[model samples]
Target: MSDEIGLILCPEARYNRSPIVLVENKLGVESWCVKFLLPYVHNKLLLYRQRKQWLDREALVDITCTLLLLNSDFTTAWNVRKELLQCGALNPERDLYLGKLALTKFPKSPETWIHRRWVLQQVLRECSPPSLDRKEQADSDLRDSAEKTRLSERLHRVLHDEMKVCADAAGRYPSNYNAWSHRIWVLQNMAQGNLKVLHDELSSMREWVSMHVSDHSGFHYRQFLLKALVRELSQSLHHHHAPWPSPGTSSPCSPSPDPQPAHHQANREATAAAPCPSPATPEDQSSVPAMPQLFHQEMELCTDLIQSFPGHETLWCHRRHVFYLWHHWRRDHNHHDGQGCGSESPQLNHTDAGLSSHPHTASPRGVGLDRVESRNGQAQEGQNAMEVDGVGIPDPCDTKRLKRGPPDPCPPALPSEHGFVASVLDGCLSPEQGCFALAYRKWLDSVIGQ
Candidate 1:
């Protein structure tokens, strides 16, 4: 038996088999057995030698289990994992053990991530909901999501906190597809509240991606941020444009306290500009008028967004819509000669006197009158050159320009065209040109004699 054990532990043998059998039975311990067994069993033997009485039969059981796991005997490995967790080992490695076993043994394992979430889920399902019932008690120890009302709020916080962890982990292993996929999963889960949290998260994610802008991950991150912004902006636009009851209408459907803005002066101007569609009666003296300035405020928000994110073409398109609506609105009430720069006719205000008194410095036939400051604080021609002919004059509004021209030589080309004019037509192209397409077109037409 001793010779047999020595043969099994021989250096040339390479037997990773369990050595517990020889060590368990009163082994005539062999040289081969000692060769393979010394490294692992050395510590256990030292403990046993120091305390001989503690080294009874059951002690060998622990040794056998250790050997099985080290040898990759999976059944014994799983048993060890269960025992470790049962003994309250809550290390992250212990959780990793659970994950590994679940992957290998179950293969189609649902338990890996589920168990990880279970720790957080247990807090809400148990501690959180029950705390609400005892809230009336003076000394209740209610905390976290223990109250029903706080459950949704707490769940959101937990998810966001985990997302930060996952994002950090992804930063360490930036090429990790799994980490990024998990982030997208979390955002999709949080999309229940019109995706408000998701939008906020993506906005933050963009800041992180900025440092790694050249990476492919950054490109994908950009797509996510843009998509989320598009959704959020669309939702906000819908809310801003939603129909609401006019103030002083006593109907129960009327919004409480009347939610309109406090720009009474602006509202009065809008009312004077366009007759209110709502009916008025002497009994409802408190009825405030409709405000076109609300539309202006909305357009201003869209315009600021376009300026802030110059690459966002959709915002520019929306701003164009707002401008068009403002134009139509002014024209509808025969207020075409309004206060804006493109007014059809000027108002005879006090400023007109000042304007008429000043010398009119006109440009030469093709040269623009570039301005210079006169000693008297007036505008004067700084230069004179025939080449400046049609330059520096802001183009007239699109409708006015179209009226002056023969019907656009051909219907405007599709937005996809890459030519100078086509780029202006497409909002996705140059916004400077798109917003000023009329001026650009006029210059091009003049230069080309088209």
Candidate 2:
């Protein structure tokens, strides 16, 4: 029995019989056995299977976690861990730590990412609602509000940590769809209602996009955040005015308060007539940057990035979404102000001013204007000399010049958002640009024409 135990434990005996050596080289055999084939793993697997059969939550959690650290793709093990989490035997934070460990080894594994999202969801569920109930004597509204605030703060911290982790994974693998999708899910679920939190998230994401311009996932997430921010701003505006009932008679059952003072009525009318530039209360003021300003800021950021990475299809796609949103906002603003969609609004003017003022200081087409001008001049002189030589054949250079026909004129600055987008897209429409660029340009034209 002692001799048999020695043979079983010997490296040569194990290497000869183990299928792990068939798949992995000698360099990994020792490490692999230490991590996955030690007596502890075999015992834990047996114990986990026993616990699973008996539905023992605590032991299952311990066993699943140990197995998961060694092999994150073990779907059954993750499912058992999920069961443990649901039954309250495993802490969500501990699950999160296990997820982090698993992800470090299996960043691209869909199972690991799905488990991470589940852990986050469980944490959120625990932090919210009936689980966070107040004592019986507590004032319901105040206690509920405080609990909600605390919940939001806790979720904000957790989601931000998750975002950092996702960003790190994405940096490691620029096209990691799982990482990007998980981050978007976190933002969509967790970052609503709080403008400061959204703004901070947007600021951080701007840095991330700048660093990872070629990654479409980051840009797509930015589009989601931008759209959400716009929606939040619109909702805030509605909320700010919801308390002030429109001027009209009240219900006969309840007497109305005294009519607004003339000065206050005038101020209200002024605010309603001109939607922009209304002063927010001190508490709400910080959250009230004009939507057009935000959109233009994003446009400039996109322009700078597109210039830096001209071939990046993701940046161009993101810009198209931004333009689409801006167009709708501009149209809505015009409708509210009793102006035709064709008429220039202040917001449109602001966008135009930004677009016109920031002339493409560098040639976008990778050819300098001066070089083109010089070539055209030389071509013209050659054509004149050929004409003097009485050669009737068109100079090839002249034919090329005619085909090119000097760069299109800088588009007339327009005050509509669609017009601005059209002009910017036109500038980007070099013959050498990608199919997406040309296709998007045509789509923009169709949208604008409609």
What is candidate 1's lDDT per residue for 142-165, written digit by digit as tens?
Answer: 543254345455555556655664
| Clash count, predicted structure 1 | 7
Residue pairs with backbone atoms closer than 3 Å in model 2 (clashes): none
**lDDT accuracy of residue 241 in candidate 1:** 34
Q: Give the winner by lDDT.
A: 2
Give candidate 2's whole-model lDDT.
Answer: 0.58
Model 1: ten consecutive residues of lowest lDDT = 363-372
lDDT of each: 0.37, 0.58
Where's the lowest-lDDT run of ten residues in candidate 2?
245-254
Over 120-190, each residue of candidate 2 has an lDDT whose tens digit, in order, gives 76775566455234564365766765766676566656776787778767776767889888876665555
Candidate 1, residue 337: lDDT: 21
> Candidate 1 at residue 100, lDDT?
33
In candidate 1, stretches whose alpha carbon ends up further than 4 angstroms from where it belongs are 1-146, 149-153, 225-238, 242-450
TM-score for all predictions? Answer: 0.31, 0.60
